[model samples]
Target chain A: MRKNGVNMIKISAKNVDVFYGKKQALFNINLDIEENQVTALIGPSGCGKSTFLRCLNRMNDVIDICKVQGEIVINDFNINDKGCDVVRLREKIGMVFQKPNPFPKTLYENISYGPTIHGMAQSKQEMDEIVETSLKKAALWEEVKDRLHEPGTGLSGGQQQRLCIARAISVQPEVILMDEPCSALDPIATAQIEELIDELKKEHTIIIVTHSMAQAARVSQRTGFFHLGELIEHGSTDKIFKNPDNIKTQDYITGRFG
Target chain B: MSEAPHTVKSYEEELKNLNSNIIKMGGFCEEALGKAVQAITMRNSDHAESVIKDDEKIDKFETLIEQQVVNLIALRQPMAIDLRETVTALKISSDLERIGDLAKNISKRTLLLNENLPKNLVDALVRVSSDVQKQLKSILDAYLDRSSSVAMNVWESDEKTDDLTNLCMQEVIKYLKENEKNLDDGTHLLFVTKNIERIGDHTTNVAEQVYYLVTGKYLEGDRPKGTEPIVTGEK
Candidate 1:
């Protein structure tokens, strides 16, 4: 892990590559995901945006056939290092997925689960405070406050996605990786989630992988355009949309092709 | 994508060429006005003839600069200040060319007045011609230098030319009223006065362009009393 309070990158990828067993899924990737700003990774489907995102906190480690090469330095530690603590690393970097995967437990316990696993709470009072604060940060506290004991599965899909966000926030991660976090939500819920992302950027560095160009244009300060597992161009969002230097980037933004 | 550097350099070159061509055309028109007025006052038919010939060159330069401006707009896709400068150049060139045309008109009047005339009336026209020539030169200088102070001077002096033209018109009317035998001479004198008045108008047009070139804004109608000074910058 990075030394406390020192100048360390939030996340840095150098010459990174990913493979699902034999077939390579990503080319040599180099990027710096900065602190407290949104960096959007945009590309067509199956272009390795999600695969690259999963490498940050070792989410790809679950797939036995997948192998990742190169360093992903978060703080001072590479999560791919042999002796690195995967659980502690994951606790510092949380993720919300494409679909809201809320647990079958009570809404209160869903948030408390991470802190309990990490031994962060000393007693019931501390655990209850963590749950309430996380829900508040996720902007779901008012609706769920009266039914803290209700099952998380009973909430609507939008609320469940927010519950997953609340669960992720409960761990107090330094960085948040969102892989199409609002893909299943309606327009209103998507807007709420986008606003939530905007607010979260003030505290945590965010890296989002999205397929929607307009969404990337709306939410990101910097946009990286990927094509066929390669980063074709990357620059300020305004330039990428209005006067892109690369033809591929211009084509993608202008709807000539993906 | 890879040609960005080349495109930028080429656009810069085109802009430079456009500016230089405008300055060159302005110089040619200024020269034509000087010779045209000199021919009228000195009664030198050769100088008057040369001024008429120079008008053709001025027209050619105006046409060339206008084509360049149009091509720059269509090809370079200029925006912001570049757009403003290109449009301003287009307007300025046309105004300069019209000033050339007025100079040609004065040359034509000079040729007509060089015919047999009363010496005193000829002397009066000579004085008026010199004064109008000075105003034209100062106005052109103000435009070239983008000097609003000089432009203001040109604006103030326009009234003097108007007063002289009115006096000349009155003199011509008196000649017509008193001597019914000299009706044709009086009519030509009236034409000479009208030509001088038109030259004054062209001088004012140049002053207006000076104001616009310096401030990138139009000045029209009555002058604003105690208005805030316009801040000058490249548009």
Candidate 2:
């Protein structure tokens, strides 16, 4: 539902915190992400941005010592609830990582794996269509359509990242969490991925965590700045880059301090 | 927010250089206006020639400031207050350069005047010039202090200069129609009055930039303007 204005709130986190044994990684963070818009999370290293991102789809649960607190609500249900099916919740939320990682299987297999496991296709022809459409959506179709049988890891770093992105979209997820997706690529490859992100936001709600303030300013409609395990500021990207309210945010973005 | 130095010392030095260059150019503009006024009121062609000759320094400062601004944007990729600071430096320098050019134009017209003028006409012109100089000085102070309130004060004071300019224009027109011999000096006086009025306008533009640099929002609504001289529609 719409909370502040015209944009619908896709995900709302209220007083969310994360702890790894004795150390608290994140303090109370309250942020509402809008649908079909890119939300960027930026801060210095070890600021809990990645931890906060992992909490969205219970990715943090895989860590034996990590404990998460508070409500992460999407559409009227809390994804953090004990009754929530993590596998089902993960199916609705896809993730891309900092490094370009593609499975050891063939390129075609990489795109089909998620759908095959999720039972999204009923026949061979349906699976092939899903593979083709996912590759095209990832903007890697023309480069790899003729070599779908080749190992996914055999591709270039940029192409492999796109392949991973293709794999993520194969399940038709509603939200995409990218953690420094372009950090390992060259400038040209980074630009291509940034363009893909702009196009992807038309169909998916995107939340990106990056140390590059320029990237956050370029791609995000909204930006949140985290510092010392606390969310220091969050607002429109323009406002954050132009005139952020908090002193810590201004200093961080302007390179005065971390 | 606490004023902290940038992590990279070089970037901080570059920004400091830009600010100093702007202040230097502002000083030159103020000096040019002062000299131009002295030339006109005291009938000193030497002072007028010096003001015109020194216009090139102001122009060079504009070029230097613009180059630094471009380099900052390309290399530093400044954000937030730094971005606004760079942009306003470019804008304020351009306005200051225009002020220098206007002051030079007034000095150029001074060289063309040979006939003696009445004391009241010269006094009115001096009043306009003095008000514009005060406005320019206040804007420069506001810029250095990063004070929006000071800039707002300068912005609201433009009407005073405009009123004085209008009065000077009327005096020149009356002097011209009073006698055929007074036409040449009176015509030159009219141009000088216009140049001084334009300098006042450029100062107001600098005031607006200072306001925007200090606070990200533009000064809201229409700028307060003074009444214009009435025009005769038809014979």
Candidate 3:
């Protein structure tokens, strides 16, 4: 169904399967990530939530033995097509990991790294403008405006995460993938990152892989419960948390088992 | 012992049983309140004695439903609206149990005020008890139907019961100040009125639970706005 003038199928996957050489990691999965909204993928430790998340941007392709099947269409373009520009596709899709892996450089240089490498910036002044805008978009400009030359590693854990987000936005990506981005931070820092995620949804479609159901409940608009290498249930956050349709989804949400 | 195929009942059947049990318990409590009021108004200690005898049945019903609620939660693991319904049943059953106690208190008062009060004071007490009885019935109806509008109406009716109880208390205290002849009877009358008012309050608690069961939102400290204005002196 269409909502708020946007197509319902922002990203569509049909009968998608992934294999790591001899072992199948995902089986006949199907899901859709809507536009300008956060969709949380939650399951047990090895239920392929992170693996499926990686498939969205073809991040799993780097693993030598991994092979993906079926079509993953984003904005009417099939990403699995051979002629698809993987580099340009990645430029429009960004990723953040479990740990806040900021580059070992100044905050300004870190945020500007993507645009500079992509040749998106014409001059040093343009790169500076891009850095400032990206930092502002990530809600970190004021905290590090005077410390632009300071090393990103000098900042605290939460600050480093926000800096990483600033770097993601620096490239002007359409979608941002967060793989347990707040798992390393304290509650207060997690709350800050969650609030930033909520704000960032106004401009970017986000897909988060979270081990914490409470975090998923707090930050996500939609949630997909994964189980045993399959997408079990995907629905509105309220339904998923309150009255999931699937028994396994209910059991997992209520802590019956992993 | 054989496993016996683990004869499991459907959740719908369990929910139906819970609803019927609540209604049955509510009916018994309603009858107890009615008879207790009659015993006070007619000076018939036998009716009060019967109500006191019926308290045991209400207690048993409360325990039965309480166990069922626990079983429902343990077995069904209900979510969302169903979860709210189970939690509300647990709370409402406890409130009903307390209302049963309040009925017992009224019967005790009836035993105390056997033949001492004058006619006018008894009339005022009868009016207060009757108002409480009507409000309690409406609250029970609201809960069973899961009607927010009816629940809101019952909540408003509780204020009327409160007003009647206050007036009854004021009349009793006035009579005490003037004569002091039936002070003990007046005090018992006050206790009975307070008990009935408390029953009204508990019924409103049940009504609030029904509201939450329907809406999935707590009605804590919230009065529904722009409801029909409560008509006074028109019970």
Candidate 4:
């Protein structure tokens, strides 16, 4: 495991590959994700960034035909171990999808969903406190505090996305994995989520899969570029965007061809 | 650092155009300095007038090159080596324009010295001018070839022009003291010598930009500066 000062490796993947029956989706991918920092995965469409991200919390196990092969260890626990509890693994490694998928429930119920399942709170008062604190952490408490009984789907696209984030953090996960969390939002909404990601990294290790290079550059400290289902290069954000060593990375970042 | 060509052909063409314009500006400044030095040595008012007129073209070159750089940044949004190349082009264009101005300033005094000349002082000025011209030409080649060592050679030898100018200023002062009747001519020669030294400085400026362009950082250590007085031979 690589260590940098006070930061430690929260997740590390080696020789990770994904496949769907006859077709391979990722090939020999390896990377390290530091604790309480943002690591962004960026590439063109169908480049397997999303496929690789699903390996973090064993999200690919849900698909009958999809097979993930690799060692994805989070805090010394192998996520792909045969007997590893998938529900418990997902709780510690929360995921936010490309679309803002808030459950068709009340706003308070959506934030309270994970804590209820995990028995994080004992009484009604404790559940109310968990909901309030999670919303505050997601920066949506002040906006949606008045109408806690309203449907989560009734909120705006940006607000619904924030509510989903609040739901993810309600479980108090150690790592939050996001897949194009702002693709459906407008520019203003995108900026808001980008800022939230930066803030979220203070408490949770975040891995984001984004199609927007600027978004990756803006939000993450370390950036990994993917091409043709292979992890091409990864480094600090400035070096990757300003002076990447690989030719493909240079072409993609400079807009020569992507 | 061998790499394949860019996939977008038109962006490559725009970058090539920017490079060609920098080389074109370099050629204009070189010719202008050559003309200024020749006009002073041969005492030809016509050559000095042409050098002065050429300054206008150099100024226009800087304007056009600046526009090209801005457009490339806005349209193509270059990164890595291309970004460094465009930024250094902007800096080199500025230095070349300043060199053209110094050459133009020298030619203005060459016109003033169309009267009875100081032959010995002009000879010393010619020696110093030739040194600066050599440095300028070498740096232009270094920039075009993307050779940091060649640019470093020019950057290191900049003090030679300053030392040569210092010696020539002494000769001019002595000639002025010995032949009191040619005081005004000797004074113009002193200004011409200082202007040549300034041109030497601008070439070094362009050399620094070339170093940064190739390596993506400033050259290690401080740049050697001219310590000799502007027009006096004082330490």
Candidate 5:
């Protein structure tokens, strides 16, 4: 909802461009993200949706050939700045990937790892509280509370994904990025994650990249459709799926063309 | 544009099947409307009975078309224009089905007047019949050719059928005034005229659907209503 008909901006990107050495991946793209809203990025394979998502948190910096140029403001910070502390920057923004990758430790340790590394908990009791709260927020507390000492890797595919989400929330990040976080899970698990996403948006800004249009339609307030490395259209999820302004967006969503 | 010919041919075939089924149903509706009118004009009770019975075929089309669309949505997960197209087909089929009901209603009135159709009522029924029949045909043309102009033409001209119906009702009343013994025929003719007018209304609705299917935008405004002209001084 808009106050006084003006949306509050949580993340803003301007003229964002990405290149793999000489081969350009993303064209100049501008997107305005509203506070406490789930923004979904959707496109065909290799349309650079994931690449553009990585630019938000500077995940592309790890790739030797990938280079991103843009102004991305997370609240008041120019995260692309050279002097910006990469370690602290990552703490403020947490990410869940296409597959669930949990730490090779107990479920309790998986949720406590981030807070412990960041010095968020001063005592063992504080650490335990963080673990429990994060797991509850991820909606995995009841399912795995009995198995807190069990290895995170020993959980079901859905349970493991929720563990990763809890781990992301453990540090109390301001924003969460999910890169097709439910792609490897079953329908029941995908539905659980979608439900968890709706709940998390109350406290954290969420941006998700998913090939499932239905998933994007389910979770996002604002949706951006990318094609051929360009932002084809960006609008409310209803308009994007019901009556998109761009023909390319319509074609891709309608399964008419890639 | 041309949808660039979908990657999956079977999806295309499924969509084609839906369109063909709708067109076939439209043909059935048109035939019923025309036969109902012919039955009254020619004083043929058999033709009137056939028109009433044929409505079952249209109801079947409604069931079949609705099921196909539901399955297509579930199995194919159509989106954007394909989504709009499937929904529009459902809407049109529904209108056509209702129009079939109106045609059946008209034939029932025809059965009541099979032995006593007033000369003026026959002429008026013929007039309303041709007017609404032409509108239905032209709207179908718009649907098949994806022509909004034709659809708009049908939309704009709906008032003429309403005017003809009003005039037919007036004639029926005048016939009753001349012969008090023919009160039953006048009452049935009054109903028949209204039925024909409603047929025009449903045809107009189909025209609006055509406009949406072609342009992907609803005709933005209140529809042109065919108001019933007030009748007075009845004994």
Candidate 6:
């Protein structure tokens, strides 16, 4: 992490490793994520990219045998410390996953749920305002404003993904983690979500794990290539795709080898 | 790092095909230039006709290579060296095509020189022709070897070709001034020398492409050059 007299890093991971019982999934890794920029993680399957993403918000804690050893510092405090509150940590770091698993609730309820639980809105009028603002930010307000009471599952796959994004931003998380969020959608829908991501990065730091190299190239400023449990290379997206420093990364991105 | 084969076998084949096509096209340019020189020096109109006819083959090669390059880009979406090589193939093919055309043009100009030229003027023009051919051969070799240093050497050697052209031009102008009947042969010889000089220029363009393909950077600064002789009859 380089300050160089300015605080550009939003998250810094040092010597981060993860293990699932007797099987080690991630090696020692260090990366500094810049503020308000989209950093993409790319690799073949079983390369530990998603594992690294989960480690950011301590999502791996749910796995009974999973253990993470890391000094993942955010804003100069190590979040891996025992004193760190997992709930509060999650509140500050929102996530949208591979599937749009919005709860079986109304559209309005979906957006209002997080803020309500966190006491973000004090009155009915404020909750309505939060719902409208979040939906508008997600670019879904125009399509879903008339159907606020409809089930979130009733929307199209792309619309539901946007609803998930709206829910993520309703609580105003500083960092958003997206794990293959566009894999399940059609090209048109994917482009919609991609456009929304371009809009979202203005207000949040986003880390995305993707298998699509073209998507990674189009959407990210910085890209990291992972291989066989190791971070092989990380640099500007242009260099990674055009002239990477590491052969493994070059091979992977250029489809010479996995 | 050791080179690894692409996972898709056909993609590897396409790239290899593109490479071989470029080399083949370069060979045609060389053959055409050889015949052009033969036509001029031997004063053989038959050789001039053959050189002009063979140029069609070179044009067909350019078309084939362009198609291959386009398919490779659209399908493989090659990156890094692959991308550079693909782009260089397109550019080098164009330059080689022009070389073939210039060679054909030289042969065409040779057909008009019915009057016998001075031995010294013919010798000087042939010298310029051979020098430009040497530059062309070295640049093609640089492309084949993927050697930036060799490409740089070829790039720097263009000055010699230009200097030879200037001397050859001065000789042809002097021969033209010696007799009014020498004007037709002398002017045709002058155009021939200019065509060869233009071929040297195109070869340098290929050298720049080769350097960029190997090193991912264009050569810095202007290319070395020699003074050009002023033409009196053209004005």
State which candidate has the highest TM-score. Answer: 2
Residue B101, model 1: Cα distance from true site in angstroms: 23
Root-mean-square deviation (CA) per prediction: 14.1, 1.8, 9.2, 3.1, 2.3, 2.8
Task: Tell me which of candidates 2 and 4 scores higher on DockQ.
Answer: 2
Clashes of each: 2, 0, 0, 0, 0, 0
Every model's TM-score: 0.55, 0.97, 0.65, 0.89, 0.93, 0.93
Candidate 2, residues B76-135: lDDT per residue as tens digits?
A: 998888899899999988998999898899899999987477889899898888898888
Which run of 10 residues does model 4 chain A get worst, by summed lDDT? A1-10
* Candidates sorted by DockQ, best first: 2, 5, 6, 4, 3, 1
Tens digits of per-residue lDDT, candidate 6, B49-71, equal: 99899999999999999999999
Q: Point out the worst 10-residue segment of candidate 1 chain B by lDDT.
A: B226-235
Cα lDDT of candidate 1 equals 0.77
Count backbone overlaps in model 5: 0
TM-score, chain B, model 6, is 0.95
Q: Which stretches of candidate 2 lie over 4 Å from their true place?
A: A1-5, B232-235
Model 4 C-alpha lDDT per residue in residues B19-109, reported as the tens digit of each score:
9999999999999999999897887889899999989999999999999999988987777778888888998999999999999998898
Model 5, residue A3: what's the lDDT?
Answer: 83
Instruction: Indicate whether candidate 1 or candidate 5 has the larger DockQ.
Output: 5
Sorted by TM-score (best first), the order is 2, 5, 6, 4, 3, 1
Location of the lowest summed lDDT over 10 successive residues in candidate 6 chain B: B226-235
Worst 10 residues of 1 chain A by lDDT: A1-10
lDDT of each: 0.77, 0.91, 0.83, 0.88, 0.88, 0.90
| Docking quality tier of model 2 | medium
**Residues A67-99, candidate 3, lDDT per residue (tens digit)?**
999999998998998988888888999998889
Q: Please identify model 1 stretches exceeding 4 Å from their true place.
A: A1-8, B1-235
lDDT (C-alpha) at residue A119 in model 6: 93
- Candidate 6's TM-score: 0.93
Error of 6 at B9 (Å): 1.5
Instruction: For model 2, state the Cα shift of residue B139 in Å.
Output: 0.5
